[model samples]
Target: MAVLAIDIGGTKCAVALTDASGDILTSEVAPTPSGGDAETLWRALWSLIETTVGAEPVDGVGVGCGGPMTWPDGVVAPLNMPGWRDGFPVVARLRERFPGVPVRIHNDAIALAAAEHWKGAGQGVDDMIGMVVSTGVGGGLILGGRLINGGTGNAGHIGHIVVDPAGPPCGCGGNGCLEAVARGPALAAWAVEQGWVPGTPAAGPVNPELSEREAAALYRENARATGRQLATDAAAGDQIAVAAMNRAGWALGLAIASATHLCDVDLVTIGGGLSQSGPLLFEPLEETLRTHARMGFSSRVRVVPAALGQEAGLIGAAALIVGGDRYWSP
Candidate 1:
């Protein structure tokens, strides 16, 4: 079967058409519309869908939406998306658009897990955790060869798992959540507070001419850049940036250790924008994981970067329809 896959993220929306083998036939992405309001976002997605599916036949639609959503119905109130906090009827709208087809929706991270389990890093692994540590940290779990969905289909929401009781407040209105302490924005904000400037020179003033207000604006801009350059600087031996990355990895390691203790998943496949930082982030993460994962089983779990890269979400979305319940949907 050919499936239409939709990946709705905080900053962008992507659409892809995939064949039964989970190969993307066509795909396209667009920035989430300004304001990110329901109508605007929906229109943007629809346009992308149309563009991706042009002259092609599709049997079903699968959507990967950011969470804090109501499942079975697919009502979303994604925390990072202010315009959607009131909830958007995602599955309902998709069903309305494609009647009589099997339209399925899952959290974006969960969808990525499905993709990884099917054709990416988690292939042949009976139990694993798939994590995306980008603008936020999100995760999905596969245990006993089945996707583990809690009653509300939010089972593998590792991001909100509290790693530190005294850590920063998360957008989910909780303290010390992994997303709040280890994600890109959180790391960048912490680095700025620690005197790291965006365009800091190796051996010169961070910024000589910029006033306090200008510096703050620059921080905002740098924070908006998603901590990628910070990773680069850290790799280049910038102390402040290295500190920030270390903090992020340490926090994540704590969470992963706890998760390993509870579920004992043997593999963690890390994806998303920040995971691209490679060893600069992974070194600290592995070091911390080694320290915290004291139990024999827990210590055995290995963390690795995702193999599918950015297309994991799109492929996972398509897998929702193509792979069916055993391999994809919860």
Candidate 2:
């Protein structure tokens, strides 16, 4: 049987119709509505679902959404998508469109976490954290063989965890959060403020102020300091690029260390565009973990890059429809 999945984001929505094994049969993409994100997003999703399910029977529907969500209950308050404050009637809307089909919805990060456990980097691990450090930072946690869905369904809002009490302000109205310090656009903005980057992208409610590709490229080009280098095949020997990566890694490690102490979760699967820096970030993270995490259990946590790339969100969303709570464990 084929399952149709839709991943909803502030800017874009991806639709995929796949089989029981999670093999894609049909796919579509649409821009999210700016002024009326919920309505526009739902409309796009409906269109995509209709197109994919046409002539082809589907087993179920899964929805992967952004954070500040009320899962199973079907509501979300994704800060990035400002037009939506209360919640989106995803379940009701999906039911209206495809009556009897079972539909499950979860935060995108949670869905991606499920995918990681099922088929991606966290394949064998019973306990793990899947994180997306993109234009924004989001995370999902699996504990004791079940998806950890809290009261608000935002159990794993790792980005908002205050890493630095004195750091820059975050959209969530906090200071020095991991999201403020290391999210894609935030990092790029930091770079631009320091004269590392020349231009700033528009900061609309829909778009952030950084470029993943551009930031990665810069990491390779301006390997000027011990803590700032563009990761590149050419700059493999450059000390600056190495340093920048180490700084990023250190930040990641520090946060993970804190999480390890709190949750006792030792395995973290890092995904998203920023993690593509790979060793540049991971190496420092390893070092930081060794220096920081005081508890023996915290030190033993294994931090690995996510095996699945962009496909993680879409695939994990589909897995949410069937896996129930067996996705990840701690």
Candidate 3:
């Protein structure tokens, strides 16, 4: 029997079947429908789940969804997802759909963290922060070899950490949040405001000749095109793009430094579209972190790109069941 894993994000949703060891056996991905109602979104995800699972029996089901949700129960209202702003009873819906199996849901970022800790970059590390810096910035905390759920299951959400009190307003209605400053879309928007022209590729409409899977992949790439273009331009000596990347990196470092001090974490694994900017981002982050994280215990902290890449969320979702003792309690 395999565990069913679901990863839901603002840009895409994925479903996978994985064995007890967390190795994916089969998977499917779809671009999350835009301008849809809550039910519409759920229907799309449900379609994927049903198609992926087919007649396969599963021992458990795990989900990683964009957060600001009521954990354990999984009533989510992801900040980036307007359709779900009114909240969706994800866990209840899944339980009804899959009856009899253990169903679990958690913040998508936390799921990625669990994956990194279980088999990726943070594999042997006992304390770490796993973060995603794409459409949004979110994270999960692992301390003393186990995941921390905090009081509201929102622990380790570093996206809203204030990096600049006077910076741009965030979707969360706060000013200068790390998410507002460093997330891919936010960073690209900032660069545009600063006169940096993003040379995003003309992905246009999905080619009619392409397979369904290829079309979905293209749609996902188009969603993050501007940010990816920014990285490319920065690499080619575009000063404005470089400045934008540096700005994002600095904010990330500042927030990570504060997190390191509070959590006493020794490692941070950063994933998502922006982290792909390579040294253009990490170099500035390292500089800012070193400057601010001067406390003796925080000085040795290491921040590196996540090793599991795009599959981190799926793997982590699987961990909620396979590695339940450490990553899941409710």
Candidate 4:
């Protein structure tokens, strides 16, 4: 049976039609309207659901969204998306659209984790870490063949982990949380602070409003920061592009060290746009993780990129509808 899948993220809304095999047959993308109210966001999603269905029938709906949500209830309050206070009832709205069909929602990071563990770089490992390094950094943990969805469905708040204490303040009211220091905005902001921004060289004045990619490009032509060069080829300079990423590289190393020390995981699968930076990101991540990790064979942990690509969520969501009690938080 085919399932309808929806992935709501910081930049855009992505919906697709997929089969049990996790193959996407059709998909669509649209900018998230800025209404800052749950009702308005609901209306926008409702409209998308209508356009997505277009008279075509599907078995069920599976959704993925940013975390700090109340699960089994489908209520979500994402960080980047304002106006979705009190958690949008995505399940209720989806059910409203498809009567008699069940709907399930998950943290996007967890869903991506689910996707990787089931059919990607984690194919052979029973314990693994699944991460998405896109506009922001999000991650999920799978242990002993089960995905860990913490109380209130907020287990994988990886991005919010404390990376730098003196760098910047995060939205979570913490100073130097990983998201604030390592996300796209921080990266761009750091570029401006460092005077590496486009039209604003180290010797020249700074461009306060310049984009991260532009700054990265300018820095690349004039600088030899291999890390920045990798970023330019990776995300094409997205918000999750440069500064946010070096932070991510270092933070991920520390995170893996802690996570591995705690759970003894043997494999790590990284996805999302930031992972696209290739070795520039991983080389540093691996080095740092090995250096600081608690004593053990953590150095043996094999870190690889995810293989499911965009279909990871759809396939993972479908897995939940068919076996949610076994795979995801129910």
TM-score of each: 0.90, 0.82, 0.89, 0.80
1 against 3, candidate with superior TM-score: 1
Report lDDT per candidate: 0.84, 0.72, 0.88, 0.71
Best by lDDT: 3
**Worst-scoring 10-residue span by lDDT in model 1:** 197-206
Candidate rank order under TM-score: 1, 3, 2, 4
Per-residue lDDT of candidate 4, residues 220-257 (tens digit): 56643333433662344433334445556787787777
Tens-digit lDDT track for model 1 on 105-219? 8899999988888898889888899999988899888998778887889889899889889989998888999899988888888988998765444423347797666765665
Ranking by lDDT: 3, 1, 2, 4
What are the runs in model 4 whose C-alpha is more than 4 Å off? 165-167, 199-230, 233-247
Candidate 4 similarity to native, TM-score: 0.80
Compared with the true structure, what per-residue lDDT tens digits does model 3 show for residues 70-116?
98899999877889999999999989987998999899999999999
Q: Of the candidates numbered 2 and 4, which has the greater lDDT value?
A: 2
